[model samples]
Target chain A: MKARIRITLKNGVLDPQGKAIQNALGSLGFAGVSDVRQGKYIEIDLAATDEAAARAEVDRMCRELLANTVIEDYAFELAKP
Target chain B: MKTSVIVFPGTNRERDVADVLAAVTGSPAQIVWHGDSEVPQSDLIVLPGGFSFGDYLRCGAMAAHSPIMRDVVAKAKAGVPVLGICNGFQILCETGLLPGILQRNASLKFICKDVWLKVENTQTQYTRRYNQGEVARMICAHGDGNYFADPSTLDRLEGDGRVVFRYCDPKGNVTAEANANGAQRNIAGIADPTGRILGMMPHPENAAEPMLGSVDGRKLFESLLAA
Candidate 1:
C-alpha cells in the first residue's frame, strides 16, 4: 500500500515563500495569477495489508510528524495495489 | 546554581551558554548529549542555539524527538527552569512546550543583528532582573524566527501574562517597523503559564559580555542565578 500526504499552511498563516514565487511569476510575464500558496507533498510505502489500517496509520503520521497542526494542516490518501 | 546545557547534533551554542552560565554562577555547567536518556540533576536546563538536525524537515523538528528531549520535557513539567534560545526556541515549540511556531522570517532572510527588546513582564524568573518595560539590546540570528499562533492562543498568552519580551525601539515602542521577524504582537520571547519554561528567538548568551557590544543580556542570566 502507498499513502500520499499533502501539508499546507493554515488559511490565516502567512506564506512568504508562496508570495515570493507569485512576485517572480508576475515579473516573468505570467499574468492572471492572482495568488499562490505553497505546500508539501509526501508519499510513503507501507507494508500493511489492510487499506483502512494503512490510512489510519498515515493519518496518525500526518498529525504527529508530517504536519505541525499549529501552523499547517495535513491530509492523506491511501491507495490500494 | 548548577546548569546543564543539552547539546543536540549540529548545535553550536552549547559552549557559549555554558560559558555564560559558569561566569554568572561561579560554577561549571554540565553538557548533556541529545541521545542521553537521562538529564543530569541540575538547577537549570538550557537548550542552546544552533542548526540542530541541520535544520532539516523543520528547524528543530528532529531534535524535539531525540531521547534526551523526553527527559527535558519531564523535568520542565516538574517545574524546572528551561531556557530555549534561537534554534532551542524552535525545538521547544516543536515539542509543544511553548505556544506558537516559528516560520520563515517575513523577509525570508537569515537576520543577524543586535535589536532592542522590551521586557514585557518582569514577574517571571527569567526577566526579574530587568524592570518592567526595560529595553535591552540582544542579538537575534535565525532564518525562521517569525512566530505564528492561532488567534485564541495569542489572546490567552497575552491575557495570562506569558509574553515576556517584545521587539521594540530604543525608547520601548513596539512598532511594526521595529519587529525583527514579523512575530505576532512583536513577540520576541514568551514563558509558559507556570513561568518556568522560556523560549526566545534572541541569543542572550552572545550579548552577555560588554565587549560583544551590549551587556544587557547579562541581566537575564543574573536573574536566573538569583532565582
Candidate 2:
C-alpha cells in the first residue's frame, strides 16, 4: 500500500513564500494570477496489506508529525495493489 | 539553581545560553543531547536557537519530534520553566507547548538586528525583573519569526495577558513599522497559563553582555534564577 499526502497552510493563514512566488510570477508577465498558496506533497510506501490499517496509521502520522494542525491542513489517499 | 540545555542537530546557540545560565546559576549547565530520553531534574530547561534539522520540512518540525522532546514536554507540563528562544520557539509551537506557528518573515529574508521590545507582562517568571512597559534591546536573527495563530487564540492570549513582550519603538509604541516580522499583534514572546513555559523569537542570550552590545538580556536570566 502507498499513501499520498498533501499538506497545505490553512485558509486565511499568511504565506509569505507563496506570496513572493505570486509576485514573481506577476513580474514575469504571468497576469491574472490572483493568488498562490504553497503546500507539500509526500508519498509513502507501507508494507501493511490492510488498507484500513494503512490509512489509520497514515492519518496518525499526519496529525503527529507530518502536518502542524495549528496552521496547516492535510489530506491523504491510500493505494493498494 | 540548576539548568539543562537541550542540543538538537544544527543547534548553534546552546553554548551561548549555557554561558548565561552558568553565570547566573553559579554552576555549569548540563548539556542534554536530543537522542537522550531523560531530562535531569533542574530549575530551568532551555531550548536554544539554531537551524534545527536544517529547517527541513518546516522549521523545528523534525527537532520537535526528537526522542528527548518527550521528556521535555513532560517536565514542562509538571511546571518546570522551559525557555525556547528563536528556533526553540518554533519547536515549542510545533510540540504544542505554545500555541501558534512561526512562518517565514514578511520580507521573506533572514532578519538579524537589534529590536526594541516592550515588556508587556512583568508578572511572569521570565519578565518579573523588568518594569512594565520597559523597552529592552535584544538581538533577533532568524528567517522565520512571523508568529500566527487563529483569531480566537489571539484574542485568548490577549485576554489572558500571556503576551510577555511585544516589538515596539524605542519609546515603547507598538506601531506597525516596529513589527519587524509581521507577527500577529507584534508578539515577540508569550507564556503558557502556568507562566512556566516561555517562547520568544529574540536572542536574549546574545545580548547578555555589555561588550556584546547590550546587557538588557541578562535580566531575563536573572528573573529565571530568582524565581
Candidate 3:
C-alpha cells in the first residue's frame, strides 16, 4: 500500500514562508492573491495488509518524524495502487 | 568543575562556547563528538549554537538524533544541568526536552547581532546569580529564533514561570524594538518545568568574555558553578 500525508502549519500559527510568498506575488502584479499557506505532501510505500493498518502506520510516522505536533498538523490516507 | 561541549558536524560555535567555558569558568570543557553515544561525566553539558547538519530538514533536527543526545537527554532527566543555545535550542525542541519550536524570523532574514535579554525568572539552578528582572546582554545569530508554542503550552509555561528570559532593550525595558526575531511574548529562553534543562535561542556563551565585548553572559556559568 501507499500513503500520502499532508502536513500543514496549524491554523492560527504564523507561516512566515507562506506570508513572504504571498507578498511577493502581490508585488509581481498578481492581484486577488489574498493569502498563501504552505504545506508539505509526503508519500510513503508500505506493505500493510489493509487500509486501516496503513493509516495507522502513516499516523505513527507523522507523529514520530514527519510533523511536529507543537505547531504543525498532519493527515493521511492510504491510496490504492 | 568539569564541562563538556557537544560537537556536531557543521557546528560553528562549539569552539567559541568551549573558549568561554575555559576562560570564564577556569575549566576547559571537553569537545564531545556527535558520533559518541556516551557523554563524559561532567558538571555541565552544553549544546552550543551553529548550523548543525547545515540546518537540513529542520534546524537541529539531524543533530537531535545524534548518538550523544540520548546520553545528554538521560543526564538532563536525571537533574544534571544542560544548556542549549541557538541551534542547540532547536535540538532540545526536537528531542522533546523543550516545549516550543523555533520558527523563522518574522523579518524573513537571518538576524546576527548583540541583543539584550531580561532575566524573567531566577529561581532555577542555571540562573541563581542574576536577579529576576535583571537584563543581560547576549547575542543572537540565527535564521530561526522565533519561538512558538500552542496557547495552552504557553499558558502553562507562563503560569509555572518556566519562561526564564525575554528580549529587552539595553536599559532593561522589554519592548518590541528589542525583539529581533518576533518570538511570542518576546521569549528568548525557557527552562524545563524542573528548571534543570535550559534552552535559549540567545548566545550567552558568545558574550561571556570581555574581549568579546561583554562579560554579562558569564554570570550564568558563575551561578551554575556556585550551585
**Scoring each candidate complex against the real one, what DockQ results?**
0.81, 0.86, 0.72
Model 3 has a DockQ score of 0.72
Over the stretch B55-115, how does candidate 3's per-residue lDDT look in tens digits?
Answer: 9767888898888999999999987789999999999999999988999899989998999
Q: List candidate 3 stretches off by more than 4 Å.
A: A47-51
Provide the overall lDDT of each model, using Cα atoms, as 2-decimal numbers: 0.93, 0.94, 0.89
Candidate with top lDDT is 2
DockQ, cand. 1: 0.81
What are the models' TM-scores?
A: 0.98, 0.98, 0.94
Estimate the TM-score for candidate 2. 0.98
The predicted structure with the larger TM-score, 1 or 3, is 1
lDDT of 2 by residue, A1-81 (tens): 889999999998888889999999999999999999999999999999998889899999999999989889999999875
Using DockQ, rank the candidates from best to worst: 2, 1, 3
lDDT of 2 at A59: 95
Go through the candidates in order and give the C-alpha RMSD of each one to the true structure.
0.9, 0.9, 1.7
Per-residue lDDT of model 1, residues B150-222, tens digit only = 8899999999999999999989999999999999999989999988899999999998998999899989999
